[model samples]
Structures are given as C-alpha cells and as structure tokens.
Target: MKPNKHSIDFGKEEQYLNSDKFVDQIICGDCYQVLKEMPDNFIDLVITSPPYFQQREYGGGGLGNEDNIDDYINNLATIFQQCVRVIKKTGTIVFNLGDKYLDGNLLLVPYRFAVEVQKRNPVKLINELTWIKINPTPKQNPKKLIPSTEPFFIFSKTDNYYFNKDAFLEYHDKCLNNGRKKVGNEIGKKYFELIDRSILSDEEKALARKELNETIVDVHQGKIESFRMKIRGLHALPYGGQAGGRLSQIKNKGFTIIKIYGNSMRKDIIESNVETIKGNIHPAVYPEFIVQELLKLLTKEDDIVLDPFLGSGTTAAVAQRLRRKYLGIEIHPEFVEHAKNRIRQNINNHTLDIFI
Candidate 1:
C-alpha cells in the first residue's frame, strides 16, 4: 500500500521544524494538535504507553487528578477517539497500561480504558496480555502488595488486520535433519559423478559428500537402511561410532521442525525486560522492545503510528526504526526534547529511515 503524501510531508515538516539536518526527525509538540493536522486513516498502527492518571508530575499538561477516575477515563476515551479516526481500517492499537493505587485500593485503570475504548464501537478487543516482568523492582507496601506486572491491551480496528505470524518463528531450515536424509543417496551419486568429471569444486564436492554420509547415518538410525548399498556406491566411510550414536539419540528425541509461515497467529503478548532510562521524565517508561513488537504486529511499512501522551518517545523511536510514520504528542517540553533527541540519534545511526 502506498503511504499518504500528507503524512510523509508532515514527517518532513517535523524534520524541518527541528532544523537538526536529520530526516524523519521527531516533532516537539502536543500530539493531539499535531494529529489533528494529519489526515485520517493514514496510520497503520497506534502503539503507545500513555501516562497513568496522576502517576507523576510530568510538568506540562501531564496526567493529573486524584479525585476522579471517571474523568480520567473520559479524557483517555477522547484521545482514543481521535486515534481511531486516523488509524487505518487494517491497523491495530496496543496500549501498554497498568493499574493505579487509590486509598489503599488497586484502581483498575487498564480495565477502565478498555471499557471506554469499547464504547467507541468501531474497534474490537483482540487480547489482554499479561506482561510478566522477570525482575521487578521491590517495594514495601504496608497495606497491600507491591505491583510487579503490567497489562498490554491489544485492540484492532477491524477483524481482519495485519499480523505476520511467520515473522516470529523460532526454527529455521538449518534446524531440520529429517528431510536431508531422503535426498542424500541421489545427491551423493551426482556429487561423485561431478567430481570424477571435474565439473564441481572441491568444497562443493566435500559438502555434498558429508551430506551423503549424514543421510546414510540417519537412515541407519531410523532403521530404514534397505538402500544402504545404493548409498555405499559413493565409497563413504562409516560415521564415528560414538558420534553417530549420539546423533541417533538426538534424532530419537524427535527433531521438531517448526515451520513459521506468514499466517502464524500469536495470542500471547510479549514482555520487555525492565531497564533504567537516563532521565526521570516519568515513573513508568515502556521498554523499546515492547513498542517494537507492537509496531511489527499492528502496523505496516510507511504507515502512520500515533502516540498521544508520548511519555519518552519509545513509541516514536520504535516506529521510526521500523520505517513507520509516527505522531507523538507530549505536553512536557523536556520530554518532547528527550524524545526528539532519541529519535535524532536513531536517525544518525540510520535506524529510523523508512527506505533502510
């Protein structure tokens, strides 16, 4: 799909506004107004970690108010409403959120956002994944337990969205040994013929010869050595007894060939390892890994990704790295500057270019 020219120009405008001589630069401004200037259905994904209500003092138009959680929900819903309008029909929205504490009670902030988002009726709830933090910060709470984990809420604009499942497959063809056996005998004979005719390189012949031996060994281990004589025509030596026995045992353990295709579906949400950031812009800043995953799963190349309340520009940086156009709104100038610098550094590293 072609990217919207307007959005591309807007990204260029950000680069020019910064006057940093860097392409695809981050803009320092409020995301809502910036997003309003952008055309609708331009973004492929909206993956963001917004500030939790009254969590910390972000200095400029930050998340505030302890008296009314309902008001917070309403404000969040308004931001998401704008997000829904700009996001493409095939796009996805992932909110990495958590709960808050109020009067010794755990406030269901993530759930509240979920309920409010559902009221829009245009988007569908995909999954509520639990981001299990392997090593969480220890805290002493006299009345209740310290919070350790957070919620990553996945939402989609339509039932049919962009998800490349095979992109995350763990196994590769190099991990497969069974299929190599069937072709070994034929390949070995061809190799010997080519070597005798001086039509193949020594390295090529050696690799083919080794494959032939491994195939014979595999057949013997599988107890299907009826064609051993055919394979023996290549005059290959028997594999080392101990090593062959170990290979047989390894094969017996069952070589699982996990074929990950483009249609692979993942229902589980991945977690990011907690790491410290340089600045204390906010108490909770999401890891770049989490944002990168969302961008890969939800958006397409050159598609716009919006982040209202972009705390530290984790979303923007990830989006830029993945070649997706991004709009990040931050009320705090310091955070905006931090996010802009982070993106500028990424651009200098050539990690934020769409063409790259």
Candidate 2:
C-alpha cells in the first residue's frame, strides 16, 4: 500500500536536520513517490532535461517512450506538478526539452509541455531560452534543415523569485558590445560631472573629459566594448547594474545596440558543442556547463536543487560541484547507480580503481 502524503513524517526541527542528510544524494525510486515524500516548499531550484518522448530506449521503463506525444507531455507535466508542491514559492524551474520529428513534420514538444504545465499548475512562464547546439548529431535529412536547437523553458512558482545575475558572468571581459550602447551613453552621462567639475585640477579634468568622450564615441561608433566601464558615479542597472542599463536594444536608426558582455553575464544563448560522456548507458547526458548556469542563476549556496528525471546524474554532479544540496530521483536502478558513481567520482576526484 502506498503511504499517505500527509502522513509522511517530517519529524521535529532537529530530526528534520538529521534527515536533511538526504541532501546531496540520489534516491533510486519512482519520481512521483519520492517527490510526494518530500516536504512542501522544500526545493529552491529544479533543473533537469527529462527524456524526450520516444527518443531513446533505456531498459526498465525509461521515460520518453510514451505511446503518444500528448501522453508523454501530460505525464511529464504530472511529475512537474508534484515538483511544484515541494518547490518554494520563490523557487524556479528550468527545463531543457528537445523536439522530435515524426513523418517529416516537426513536433514542438518543449513548448507543448510548457503550455500544458502552465495550464495544469499555477506557475508562471517566466522566460523562454534557446540552446543552440553547435555540433548536433547529423540527421538523415539533407532536404530539410539540420536540427540544431532546443528550447529551455524557465518557470517560477510565484511572480517574485530569487535570481543571481552574477553567477553566469564568466565571460565578463567582452560583455559591453553594441547591444548595450545605451548603457555606454548612460555611463557617459553619469560621469559627465566628473569630467565637467570634479576635485581635480584643470589639466587633470581636461584629460578625464577627453578620455570619457573617446570611450563614449567608441561605444556609439560600434567599437569593441567590455563590461569594465572606466567611469565615475556608478549606478545600478537592471539585469546587473554594472552595465548601467538593460541588455540588448535596437535604436531608431535600424542598428542593434548589443551588449556583448555584462558585469553580470551574457545573453540567453548558451553555446554548447556536445561532449560525449564515457561509459554512460544513457543516450543523453546534460552538459555540466548547462546545469552550472541554471544552478547558479536560480539557487544560492547550500540551497536544495532537485532533479526528478535524474538521467545519468548531470544535475546532481554539477550541483555538488557548486556546493548546493541536491536530490535526484531515478526510476532505473542501473541509471541510479551510474548517477551515484558519477557524483562520487566528481566529489573525490579519485577514480574507483583497484590495485591488485
């Protein structure tokens, strides 16, 4: 008999802390059952790329092998609904779903799932990002355009959520491209006084003014730009105040002012040349960089990150490296073992080898 959802004990605060040791570990079982056992508003972030419908066959009742596309989407939505119960109101969910082609037609599985999920739950559809696969497996169709991109749908349990803009600022050096030229203009304005009437001498002020004008000209003229704006009077901007303005914008002159880099981060496009996972039975293993970006953006240190479709444990491994607690649920025992061993290897940095 199945255990009652409410009856599942959360114990006292001390006991809960002891049991919270379940964090950073993979529980091999059905996702629905395991998620039902978890406490409400327990997870801070949920990032996972569940198996695509009818994409692959991993023995022992793997996902993505549903009878129909609608069936598969509905099933996935049901699991995510359970995830919503455990996810905090301020939490976020980033699901990376790929599309499939049937009878020479494209099926928008990712968007379909997004709509279905929102319809069934009270979550908000926050953002829609695209993951362009630079090196995707060659398709048999030369007549049709080669498949190269996937949809990354971001959802929030509530309108207000926690987002760390600085987490994905790895390429900060070349962030201020033409996309953020308006930011450059704003920076020029903010520092106008420093160049106009600062505590510096006449000669020093003249030199500062020249430098500021040159930088602004460079920005307006579509010259190379970076996030490190050398100006005075710093003010915050949306999506990371370092830039002093918003992201990409198009001017009336038909030119796109693109901020190639931000003090906080880059654009929605995550460039990935898929790398093969060695000795992994699962057909699809999420790239570590992808998981890292999502975790950093949606979670904080020691926050609970849950992955219901824990195929090969990419999310778990990345979460461990990021120092955030992780909870993974996988139905297949073999895949579960794969995830556990992978996590162990990543954490120890020592291979499990025998010296006989």
Candidate 3:
C-alpha cells in the first residue's frame, strides 16, 4: 500500500460494506447502520469529532438533531457503544465534542457524553485532553467572555491499548522542547560552595559533592542535557508539582536534583485553531496537525484508523500521509464528495517523503 488513493462509488453500493474492503476507502453511509454491519475487533484506532448538538445545520439529521440533551447523549452514546464493540481489545477511541451555550448557560455536552458512554460500555477513560482554540468564535453576549476550549476524551476497552509514549513525547518536543542546553564554564562550582556552607554534617557535604560531581560528569558525557541541584539549607525546596517525589527526596536525603532530558513537557492541553479547508463544505473541521499528533501517538504504519463522522476527510488525509490505512464513513453525499476532492488534493500536495 504505497500511497495509493482508494475510490468508491458510494451511491452504487446497495449492500452493506464488506469488512475486507474497508482499508483506504471513504464511504457514504450512516454510521450506526454501517458499523453494525461490520464484525467485531475491526478497527485499530477510532477518532472523530461528531456533529455538535444544534451547533449548526449538518443536513444529515441523525445524531445532532435530537430535541433534548438526553436524546442527543443517548444517540451519541449508543453509537459509541457500537464503536466499542467494533474496536479491538487494544484499540483506543478519541472523541472530540464541543460545548454548546444556550439560555445564558453552558450545557456540559462533552462531559455528559463521557459519563454516558462509560456507564454503558466496558470502557475506561484513559485521558481527557483539553484543546485550546487559539481563535474561537466570537460571542455577542456582553455578559460573558468567549469560550475557547473543547474536550477530547480518550477511552479504551481494556488495559492493553497501544500507547507510544516516546512518540507522544516527541510530538511535544517538536512543538515546545529545545535541543540540549549548553552548560557554562562554572557548571557545578556554585553547588560545591552551597553544599560546603550549608548547616550539614561533614558526611552530608561529602555525599552532596559526590553526587554533584557525578551529575556534572553525566552532563559532559552527554547522558543528560542539564541539571539543577537544590541544597536543603540554601535553595528553596523542590516541588515536583502534584507527584512531590522531588520534595520528598530533598527532605529525606538533605538535597534535591532537577534533571532535564529535553524530551517532553508534561501537558494535557494543546493549542490549535479551527480549520476550514478551501474545498470543504462542512461547517466545522478539526485541525489536521492535531489528528497527526494523535495518530503518531496511537498507531503504527498500516494500522487501520476509522472516523465515523468524516466531515472533510481530515483523518483520511492524515492517515494516508503517515502511511496508515483509513476508512471514513460520511452520511451526506455532498460532504462525501467534498471529502473525496479534498483528500485527492491532499495526496497530490506532498510526496511520501515529506509531510508539511
């Protein structure tokens, strides 16, 4: 499967999808009906941002057109229950749902959906990712500030879900991490002085000096990028945020060390603006880079990625670019056509060697 574009005449297909032909094809069909037809343990990674409840006119009046919030939740949750059945034991689902504001108050649509799906299925909530929109839609209500965040809930049916933490770390490193830090000429000299001047027994000073010297050797030998030592009496106590391991180590051992590997920043929040592709007719589309990051974190080459609510084929495009198999189910024929054209253009824009 060396970067070939799949073509499916969705209108001519009078029968349900054959599971073997799901790879690299974007089909026009209702999600629940289509998913029910597929067998169990099919997809490797499931990712989609379904139509928001009453956010806009999707023209396909199934999931988003429910009268009340409960109806909407039930519809979405039932579909998710089907999704859970289709994914493998090690598969993961990443669902991004937007919040709706009505009658001067907010409806916790995403959170409520999270609760509903977990209650109905044999799934575990792995993580809640908060996507911060750099440019959000403006609100004319003078009484309230603008809403700029949405949630992407990640779920897994079992504990064997595939998570490439090194790839996840590399994703953040590309965005927020710099290369190895350069040390000054007097790297550990100040720590030696602080250790000697501290109110500690001679034994404590000797141990501190030994550890500091070893750390300096590690830095120079390129084992680590950089480090900072906090003396018990001189420097403020180190805070390891909520984990508090660093602070406990300082209290017990009379010193603490901060090590920077320059690999990752521990963060659940990501910043991406809403995207609108040129040929895309869908009202809402998530950013491509966000999908790429998640794909890198959760999948390997040739793994199947499914997006049930394929608006503009963002998932398909990113999957193809990354050399992964993708199957998208779009209900609207017009949106399906748009997704096809957009994905074709996306394929032509770059070769397999480089992804912009």
Candidate 4:
C-alpha cells in the first residue's frame, strides 16, 4: 500500500515542530505513514528498539516477522531513510537491536542492520554500546553462553552532533590511597634508602627527605585531586600535584588513576537488571534506565524526541519525565491503548508535580 502523505504548513522544519499538535502526543498509525508527513530536520533525537526479525506479529502486516533476511534488512532501511530526513543536522539516533535465530542458526541482526542503514542514509555510526542485562531469560539448553547482552548502535546525522557529556555523571567514593602502603611507612623507607644511596651532602639529603615527606603528606590528606589522564609522550602515572621536574615526572610514571567528573569514558558498557513492569504486556520493553541514559546524552529541555516503535510507552514516559517533548507511533491498536494507558499512569503518578 502507498503511504498517505499529509501537508506540512510551517515554513521551516524548526518552526514546524513549534506547533502544539506534534509535541507530547502519541499518533496511532503506521510508522511509515506518520514519518513521511513530518518535516525535515524537525526531530532532535530518535531512540527506538525496532522489532527483531521473526520476533513478533503485532497485528500490523510489516517487516518484523519476515522470513527472508534480505527483505527484513531492506524494510528497515526504508524506515531509517525517513528517520535520517526527519532528524536535525546535529541530532543522533540510538537503535537497540537484538540477535535472532533461524533454524537454530544464530543470525547477526544488529551488525547487519547497522551496515545496511548507513548505506541508505547519510548517518554515521559513532558509538557501539552493549547493554548487559543482568536478569535475562535463561535458555533451556545449556550448551551456549547465556544471552545477556544486546547492542545499541548510536548514529549521527552530521560529523558534529549535540552530545551532553556532563549530563550523566556517576559519583563514586574512591579511596585516596590505593595499591600502596600508608603515608610514612613505605614512602618513608624508600626516601631514606634513596638519601643513603645518593652521593650528596648531609644538608642536600635532609632537604630531599623533607620535600618527599611534605609531598607524601600532601597527597595522603587529600590536598590534591587528580582529573583526567593527559596523553603524554611517555607512559606516566596520574598525579594530582602541581609540581614539575624530572624527579616528579619519574615518580608519577606507572599506571596511575585519575578522577573524571563524568563517566563518558566508560559508557560503552551498561549494566542494568531487566525490568518487569506490572500490566505491561509487551514482551520486549526497554528498561527506563536505558532510555534515561540515552536521553541524557542526546537531548536537552524541550527538544523533540521520537520513537517509531513505541512498545509499552517506555520512551515517551521517560521523555516526559525528563522535561523533553515526545512523539510516539504504534501500528497496533491494542499497543496504542497500552502505550496511552502507561503514559497516563506515568504522568499521573510519577510526573504530576513536574507538569504542575
């Protein structure tokens, strides 16, 4: 069937989304039909987990349950082509795709989709994240490794995308001294041994010992704080002091630990327990933590977020809770009602104070 197109009235794509009709609304229609009507460069971020191949039959005659792998990839390419047009130049698209099996043979669906989508669209795959579900369903056969990880492929419309690196900060209480003896024990012994071995005057030896003691005290009491590791010419340890010299540099040389405010450096692996929401009949619902993490990285306040396969309304509810505008499209009427009810309960019970 040919997609029914609707007229877009606003002069520019940016102005088109300013109208109230599209924001914070869920449209019950086919994803292709709804996506074709949207103006170009209108959506700020796109986050969705499209149905896997031969996974589910959602009462909509579409690509998820296609037996042929080539047909499945082709159908997904068409949907993402529309997504590339709708997303802004500085926007990002995060797709969480899972693996499937055909006749007991494992099909690498996520990697194939990533490669095929890039061929059809101008988007580039920037980051590949692994969602390690702690409580995934156990397979009856114990021959293979337990299925615990899923892939999240992050794509950007342009070379420079809008990413908020500081939004997802993880606070950890790290000890000041690690993998070393306490102050005045191991360091003091090493300093005295150095002073005795060196061919220097007594005064010089005393001065060196005093400086080393002061440095150790300063570091042990948390007087200094280390940030990120600077990629220097040599393999140096992380040091928090403001001192500079050949000795100081040599002292801070082997594997050092640094403290960065944000956890962007370690975001490639996500560890979360699988979520089980009461009354949610959708078998493949994403946890709220996953959506929240993606939103923090990709969107800002009032930015428009779109979910083409709005299963159980996890994305919309999380987007609303984060103060961003959202638009959801679900093809099945039963899922449309399911998503609406879930969004309503989320707004009423969780985000009521924020909206008011």
TM-score of each: 0.63, 0.71, 0.86, 0.73
**Clash count of each predicted structure:** 1, 11, 0, 0
Candidate order, TM-score descending: 3, 4, 2, 1
Q: What is the per-residue lDDT of model 1 for residues 211-268, given as tens digits with 9 covering 90 to 100?
A: 5466555554543332322122233333575546434432342111111222123547
Tens digit per residue, CA lDDT, model 3, 235-292: 7765556538777767777787787664354467678887866756777899887788
Per-model CA lDDT versus the true structure: 0.62, 0.70, 0.80, 0.72
Best by TM-score: 3
Q: How are the candidates ranked when ordered by lDDT, highest leading?
A: 3, 4, 2, 1
RMSD of each: 13.7, 10.4, 6.5, 8.1
Tell me the lDDT of model 2 at 248.
27
Which pairs of residues collide in candidate 4? Answer: none
Tens digits of per-residue lDDT for model 2 on 236-338? 2235554333222111111112333223334776767665777887878877766777777788889989998898998888888777889898878889999
Model with the higher TM-score, candidate 2 or 3: 3
Using lDDT as the measure, the top candidate is 3
Q: Kindly provide the TM-score of model 2 when superposed on the true structure, using C-alpha atoms.
A: 0.71
Could you tell me which residue pairs clash in candidate 1? 31-329
Cα displacement (angstroms), candidate 4, residue 344, comes to: 1.8
